[model samples]
Target: MSASVANPNPNKSFEVVQPPSDSVTSLSFSPKGNYLVATSWDNQVRCWEITTTGATLSSVPKASTNHDQPVLCSTWKDDGTTVFSGGCDKQVKMWPLMAGGQATTVAMHDAPIKEVAWIPQMNVLVTGSWDKTLKYWDLRQSNPVHTQQLPERCYAMSVNHPLMVVGTTDRNFIVFNLQNPQTEFKRITSPLKYQTRCVAAFPDQQGFLVGSIEGRVGVHHLDDSQQSKNFTFKCHREGNEIYSVNALNFHPVHHTFVTSGSDGAFHFWDKDSKQRLKAMSRCSQPIPCSTFNNDGSIFAYSVCYDWSKGAENHNPATAKTYIFLHVPQESEVKAKPRAGTSGRK
Candidate 1:
């Protein structure tokens, strides 16, 4: 049988979903909020539906596709009508939603493709690679229409309309304004010295959150006045070793966000109040990726070895891993008014 976890704490109840055979590298919620696609080190992209009723996994994977190498990342496009995935194979494949269709190889990269994002406003697909380049694609034809060199291999990226932020391995941020594809956009130095692990946009698009492998996260604002809202926190660390923060995403409605890390835990923080609302139960292995379903009703996370120590950590004898479906309590994320305890004295 596949792995499963049932925490006795009714308040933090969650259901284990059908898991991939190998490690999960990333997870993304479909735009419609009904399903989620997980890209895994098993060389497969698996899609599973998110049901409304319980903390139980309602169904098995709706579809599963394979890649030549271990898949690393995935994203939805056309409002969930299609999906795109990339991996160590250096190939990007587009999968259609309707049943019985094969995926199309959309493009290729010189090195592993670290990220694949669809610019809905521009109707284009952008991919960042360890090859030290960012390329824009037009699905109608082969080969990227434009390509720009980067200072270093891109490890994380976040988009909040108008602006695109690419965080590289060398502690540099390459920011771009979607409107003017050209022109050298702004460059921002990172606040931390560790390798960037994840970057997520704020709901309002004014700034973003950057998380590092050293268990440090910094808040950044685009303008001066909002800069006061910025803050930094150290978490996911135990004694000396710091766990890598694997994922960061904002709640669509509440504007709050959740952070997951290699320590196998998820924590909800209310940025407006500078307080942690909750920290979910920890699993046996690390949670490599997580995301909130579009409507904010459900959250999915994969628990597996994320290769943080490189191939040396891979153990074939390791037990099976899993993906879980959690229904966060409304009260846990419900935003508090300024007068509430999270606000002022």
Candidate 2:
């Protein structure tokens, strides 16, 4: 049994009151903090308002909307008043949160939309589809503002201001400088040998992290001169059993990042020091998605079947979905000193 499940600590961590009824595909915290939006295979997009009083935390359901099919991804607008969600229905819907109005279709794709992101800098919403194309939507217009093709089906994507990294099927990594939203900044093959599972850009926009199905993560720097600093590391493996790395999220404040895997474990790592900062006890089920709050004070993760093993392996009677919130100590997320330096030991 996982330590967290065995010993529930209300002060350090707590489970939200109500969670998605099905597999949670993605999680997005409001840029303004206090709100969290989750998209799930149940075809529902739900919002919750997070509140804290002393050591106790609670979540109040704010609003919920649905899609025609499983919602794959979601993102919040910079002002915190709107949310954009996409799904297997191949449609992207924009929700005006404050107004409590019905969602409207703002974008469409030829196939399932795998990822949806709000490019605040460009004031546009970008969607990546399994149709192997990326489309930027202006919202006001009837058509996409711009569309860029990918090498294969879109699997995962991460954006930080001007930097956007898209991981597609066939191990293709497409990088984009959002400043030049219409063109691809560069394209490269994934450093990891297995299929890409998730990708996250570094907080500084210097590079990005890519996780693969073989339980490994590749740290790649965009600049040629920094290529030598790039490397891949193994994680989430227990002896001979290797599981896919399902999610990667960078700390908004500390810059160190965390990786969740199909093995039901998550670990924080400092890329610069080449060391693991902290590793949480494994859960009973896979963690399909996770994210940090705006200020990085809390980490939210969903515990559920990832569907990687196919529908045959999923037992509805036995499966239970949960969303947990963990508050990390400063030492747990802050970067440690590099080798040869005396520090927090």
Candidate 3:
């Protein structure tokens, strides 16, 4: 078991595993919880296997494939036999996992796909793109089964409670009811002066967590009939822009949460106290996205530089991918300390 600390300092020490050079733009873990997939500005998607015997720092990727443009987002299928990615070239592609540990492209999108997600129970795929539209595709259909348009550019999104919540550059969130195709259920306004970068909903779909560029996170209750806000908190210090906020599956199970930001830092918070328990800076470049493993034992993140370099020349040498292993706390370490000085005979 990994070691744990009591009210651990926000800067508690943890292990970091670095992947091959590449500016990581997006990250997702496999459904089976054995691997992690990362997309980078190098137009490549790489997968790494998770192991508990201490990460092999110099190990190469288990699989890697090229895209036409910078891959902005990716996700794995429910069966873990395929991976999907969206890129800057206005395309969404599917890759099938072969028995020999190789991936082959199988499908493509019409526009630059910004995000992709697979619904396990419905056996459907959903995608959001710069075309200002959200499309739902049936695995068996050749064309999109449904599409929804948004008023502004979409940055990030998530689906919960059969509803799609989309974050936009305009600092607003739109909730679309999947059951009722024609209904626009709610338009959530952020309490920030800047755009909303990311949004995540609780596993139970009872509440949601929204991250803003102004470095704040708002927790809201989901209620269709009432328009009341439950509570909100300043998750980060005043100046650091919260690039992303992802609720780990472990957090719900362990009552803890984590957040990443442009400041190149990751913070762990306890739900009960709403206090920051741990913090660590993983990269010098900005972290665009991050997600926890299915088992909640590990998480992955991607780092890419700001506008100093040209987009086409964004090589893997300049980009980096990081995986953090959660060190479990020991019962003795978490136990209360006794009072008295050793010299008091």
Candidate 4:
């Protein structure tokens, strides 16, 4: 049986929606919040419609053959009509929501493309790969507008407030000013001596949080002169290395943030207090990716496993997709005592 836990408030619940494919690698919600996009090892990107009715939960995935190799990451454009995906085939494919669903492939990297992000305001597409380099592509042009080399392979990245943050396997996080995307502006080293699996910038763009394999999460200030740990949390005290951290998002109107790890669990915390507010049970397999809806009222995750079906098998190829609605605790509406009862005792 799968174990589960709830917080004092215990407001949210999850419903598992099986995808047509088994090895989903990443999950993203459309800007409109009506659809969820999942990239898988099946070399396909699937779009699922989210709905609740008739006492049943289901996902309708719009299957489209877009990549030749396993899709590693996917993201939606600001307009929500266009979707972008990168794969092991070293190609970045763009899928337009209209027409015949034609995919435009862009050859930008030599090695597997690990992550992709689109800057809507500047109309720039940024991708990082196993090539140890980050490239910025102008969608209007056929070639990469700029490229910045790093010391190690980059796995995940987040862009906000015109600043780009890249997470590398070298246990370092690099920040670049998009105003000058051609140069590396700052770097933050991990305190636990472990590689950063994922990095996410706060919604306010004032700081960022990094998750490491050592099961430690570090929050850092963004200002150059004020670089320091704002808060730290030990996810696992026994020192179990967190294989990966996929989903990180802040609530739409609150200081709360959510995170999911390879441990098959999702955690919610107050960014300011650094206190874990809730922990929810996840899929039995490792969660490879996660993202919140634009409104933060809903969240989704993709659970993936390696393909080893033997005695020492830990990672499997099959994966599952899940989506949940975050239900906030209802505030108590206490009625004030009668004015005459104040000192009666």
Best candidate according to lDDT: 2
Instruction: Name model 1 segments beyond 4 Å from true.
Output: 1-13, 54-57, 340-345
Global Cα lDDT for candidate 1: 0.81
Where is model 2 poorest over a 10-residue stretch in terms of lDDT?
Answer: 3-12
Ranking by lDDT: 2, 1, 4, 3
lDDT of 1 by residue, 1-345 (tens): 134653222234455567788888888888865777888878999887766553454645688899999998899995778899998999899999655579989978999999999999988899999999998998997989899898999899888778888999998988888897655478888877788999987777777889988888888887778777788898787789789888887888888888888877888888877878887777767778888888888877877778887888777676356777777787667666666456422
User: For candidate 3, lDDT tens digit of each residue in 173-212?
Assistant: 8787667744677887765556677777655566667777
lDDT of 3: 0.63
Worst 10 residues of 3 by lDDT: 1-10
User: Which segments of candidate 2 are over 4 A away from where they belong?
Assistant: 1-12, 339-345
Better of 1 and 3 by lDDT: 1
lDDT of 4 by residue, 12-120 (tens): 3545455635566777878765677878877888777767564443566555656888998888888888889998999899888534488888646989999999888
lDDT of 2 by residue, 171-271 (tens): 99999998887888999899999999999998888899999999999999999999999999999999999999999988888888999898888889989
Per-prediction TM-score to the true structure, in the order listed = 0.91, 0.95, 0.78, 0.83
Error of 3 at 143 (Å): 0.8
Candidates 2 and 4 compared by lDDT, better number: 2
Candidates, ranked, TM-score:
2, 1, 4, 3
